[model samples]
Target: MQSNLSSADAVERIVGFFEHLSAADLVRIGELYSADARFKDPFNEVRGIPAIQGIFRHMFTALEQPRFVVTGRVVQGDQCFLTWDFLFAFRSYHRGVTQTVRGASHLVLDADGRITLHRDYWDAAEELYEKLPVVGGLMRWLKRRANQ
Candidate 1:
């Protein structure tokens, strides 16, 4: 049987687990997630453990030295809100350029202290689209026009 924990302990454990997450961690993801966990981010949405692991696997494949830094967090009841930064260098397209995306996650824990729903919120235009070579130019132009 899975062990249950307090919300605070669960949050702290999760933060520690995510700080060094990698392809190897996928196998142990169930340590923190229920069987039906759902995860969503700016680019992808998936449910279940395998789907969630695939997302991280793609992250490793597409980015060099990608990592997550938990800047802060708040846990209340069965829900936790976490603010974080994703740092990585594009493996091909934007090679050599280090990218950082500031974002937040809303996590819901089940009675067994396993994650049930994890949703990430970030600005694609400012954080991702603006970093691309061509799209960035157009995005900046649009921003300037809107401001003026």
Candidate 2:
């Protein structure tokens, strides 16, 4: 059997996934993930819902009022690419070092309408490393040198 859904519909579903995320809802992550789901990023290569939920929980703790706002999204077949801005404040850092990181995630949906593979592509050096005090200065210097 074949199902037909528009690209806009797929993108809506992807956006809904992030919009409905709540700290307590981490337990229901399995409902959105395939049995053999895989998630990859620069810092993590996690598989399965449990591992993904662990990362989400960590994110909840690490960022104060962390929320993902979808700026744009595109879908083609079973794959959806979403651009988003993450707004959060890290309490561990200085008193007023809140961060807004812009990034994108590519999600592949399974036949059962669950996310099978999720890959996030973003510049860590620019979004994260460059936000730090000392590291930011060093990264900026390195970037200047590389561009020269």
Candidate 3:
């Protein structure tokens, strides 16, 4: 579990990894994250590579044709920001409904080129809650009311 890549290369590798994520890739999580890495998103805040891998594993099980499209990237020193669109078809909940969640990830790589911190920024109401059946209607109504 060693890499001779720079911080920028680490970011590139991460983006490329998610673009074609599969179950087998879970074993290689250590290649991308340090043993004590922290990963946080709107719904989950986890520490360690194993927990991070678990989140991704659940994603593959819950979604169909899931992929990440990196739209933009900015790297400076050991930190980088990546803009992306997560495209997926809902498996059980909204089966067959394709959805896209535009988001960004802020990653910090350690001296070893493994991620130490990974935080994702995205709107849950717009990306998920608003796409549900009953929740969608309520979310829309609440949005209109708030706008009024």
1 against 2, candidate with superior TM-score: 1
- Backbone atom clashes (below 3 Å) for every candidate: 0, 0, 0
* Candidate with better TM-score, 2 vs 3: 3
Q: Tell me the tens digit of each residue's lDDT in model 3 across 1-148.
A: 1447877777878888888778888999998899999999999999998899999999988889888899999999888999999999987776887899999999988888888999999999988889988999999999999999
Where does model 1 exceed 4 Å of error?
1-4
Ranking by lDDT: 1, 3, 2
Local error of candidate 3 at residue 127 (angstroms) = 0.8
Give each model a TM-score: 0.94, 0.89, 0.93
Alpha-carbon local distance difference test for all models: 0.90, 0.82, 0.90
Q: Which stretches of candidate 3 lie over 4 Å from their true place?
A: 1-4
Residue 117 error, candidate 3, Å: 0.3
lDDT of 2 by residue, 44-104 (tens): 9999998999888999987787888889887777888888898777777764556888989
Q: Write the per-residue lDDT of candidate 1 for residues 55-109, one digit (tens) a residue.
A: 8888888889898999999888899999999999987776877899999999999
Question: Between 1 and 2, whose lDDT is larger?
Answer: 1
In candidate 3 the C-alpha lDDT for residue 56 amounts to 92
